[model samples]
Target: MEAFPRAILIDLDDTLVDDSSNVDACWDDACAAVAPRLRGVGVDRLRAAIDRRASWYWSDPKRHRTGRLDLRAVRRHILELAFAELGIDDSGLARDLAEMYRQLREERAQMFPGVIDTLDRLRAQGVRLGMMTNGAADAQRAKIERFGLAAYFDHIIIEGEFGAGKPDRRVFEALLSAFDVAPGDAWAIGDHLEFDVLAPMRLGLHGIWVDVRNAGLDGRPGRPHRVVSAFTEIVETPV
Candidate 1:
């Protein structure tokens, strides 16, 4: 809290952008639309099944790495598995559900409040800024462009383009080196504790966790150097 770091590496989703906040609502909308056609499977049941499969799918680091690149396919696969669990054999319906969720999710995507102002302030203060996000190149780039975020970052690294993502110390090392800042003089901020916090902290960068949901660490491994509830907190006038 003494002074801003010389450089900061930020995450895109849930940290700068409000991407994950509407997930449950979007899933509800998608499930409700297809519930009637799912034999006796109600909306709640279908949603639960899909949620379970999705959790399991992403729980594995290997699948999470591969699945994040092709999220549409991941959704479709989750829907298919859910349908199968409920005795439904319609791949077309599963695809439809996946598409619906995608559309609904995109419709509601927006950056978190004060993100642009915070980034602008940091930049104005001569702080080097960068963004490191994981996902397909095109998909990640689209979000960057859509949110007009490209102007704020000096370096933008997408996992698909970078050949790897967070939890990989190489990514953090490369970005800090790009900014010509020592790890201890830079900060890495993101929502994922392991990827954004632990990984960077291990390499000597100050790791700041954005707890958007106000979710406590809940005994998660590796405490962040700083924990904040919003992006704007990063630039709040030091007390």
Candidate 2:
């Protein structure tokens, strides 16, 4: 029943937005954009290979931290792998596909249910809001503008712009500094346990896992301080 935190930092992908649709659209667009350059190579095979490699590298923390699996890097590496296997050599085509996919991703972002309304209510309650995402500025900013979700936040921090990704305390620290709030005075909410919950919790912030699917990531030992099913639950719950 105590209102301990005055500000909230929210994650963009899969937390406030339905990013799965955006990702799917990007994949489709990437395949089509690269298909002509594939030159008789099986598009399905190439896409499957890229998906496998992307998932493998993305889920591995060691590979991610070692600079082997960041977003742009992963896209380029996957294209290289696919082209190498198909005996193709066209870096220009790969670059074009990457850029196309990036644009498509921003265009396809769909805000999650209750996102705008909940944010509006939170702002009305005088809660300081901030955004923390891990992607290039153009894509993230585009999504915010497309969805008209930018004005609710006091600060927006993207890892790509900051030269570091989350689960790192420095990213969260920057957000806290921008909000002029102490760690304990703010709450970090995101869908990802490692990046969104654990990272901020390590910095003594009140991390809240937004488990929309009810997967119970918070039930694990040493996770976020709290977990909720949706953003609306934050205001309703006893703080």
Candidate 3:
């Protein structure tokens, strides 16, 4: 563990970027944006309803897989359910609200602190890098371009492009192969314990969990090779 990894496979959302952290805030903003158009519906009430429906929608593994790929449709469906719960019957309004949320999220997207510098240092050290993300191609590509991430990576695998995503061994294997680096010489880093850590560990790759929320393992199933609260820590000596 003293030596740096030969290669690295990292995740996009919530790991290097700040997208999921602002989800609720963006939802609130979207709800407020459409408040004037809602009849007899308070912004707070609508937001709460949408939040509840969204929770239910993502709780299922199947829905989560499908929903992440088509977030707009998922949001529209969640809004429709929220509308039904509130006795509002406007499909057009629901669609517009979903699109509003999507735009708000995109406009506010940002990378985690020091991510650019960390990636730069890794590249300077001759560490092979790959980005493994699960989302629609356009959405993932937009973030990569916006943050100038492509220049730092040797391989970029989006679920929409690969036709599969993380926690699926194939995606992880493909990335390691792309770098021509053995699993033991590489690390999988991300916020999601399952997709970023356990999945790659299963393939003999070191797993580094970026606990950006400062949330400890708290009896989480698998053990990560290392855990740090930020991306910058990966370059430093292991704690």
In angstroms, give how far residue 82 of model 3 lies from its true place: 0.5
Candidate 2: where are CA atoms >4 Å away?
A: 1-4, 21-25, 32-37, 59-73, 90-93, 177-180, 212-215, 218-221
Superposition TM-score, candidate 3 onto the true structure: 0.97
**Lowest-sum lDDT 10-residue window in model 2:** 64-73
Query: How do all the candidates rank in terms of TM-score, highest first?
Result: 3, 1, 2
Question: Candidate 3 lDDT, tens digit per residue, 1-239?
Answer: 35778899999998888887788899888888888889968999998898899889999999999889998888889999999999999999998888888888888888888989999989888899999999999989989999999999999999999999999999999998888888999999999999989999999999999998999999889899899998889988886
With a 3 Å backbone cut-off (N, CA, C), the pairs that clash in candidate 2 are none
Residue 190's lDDT within candidate 3 is 94
lDDT of 2 by residue, 1-239 (tens): 34636789899988998776457557776887678778887778777776776787678877676543246767787777767766778888777877787667766767777788889888877889989888767767777888888898888887767777787788889888987889989999998887898889888898888886678753566657778877667767555
What are the clashing pairs of model 3?
A: none
Task: Please give the lDDT score at residue 66 for candidate 3.
Answer: 89
Candidate 1 accuracy as lDDT:
0.89
Each candidate structure's TM-score, on Cα atoms with residue i matched to residue i, is: 0.96, 0.78, 0.97
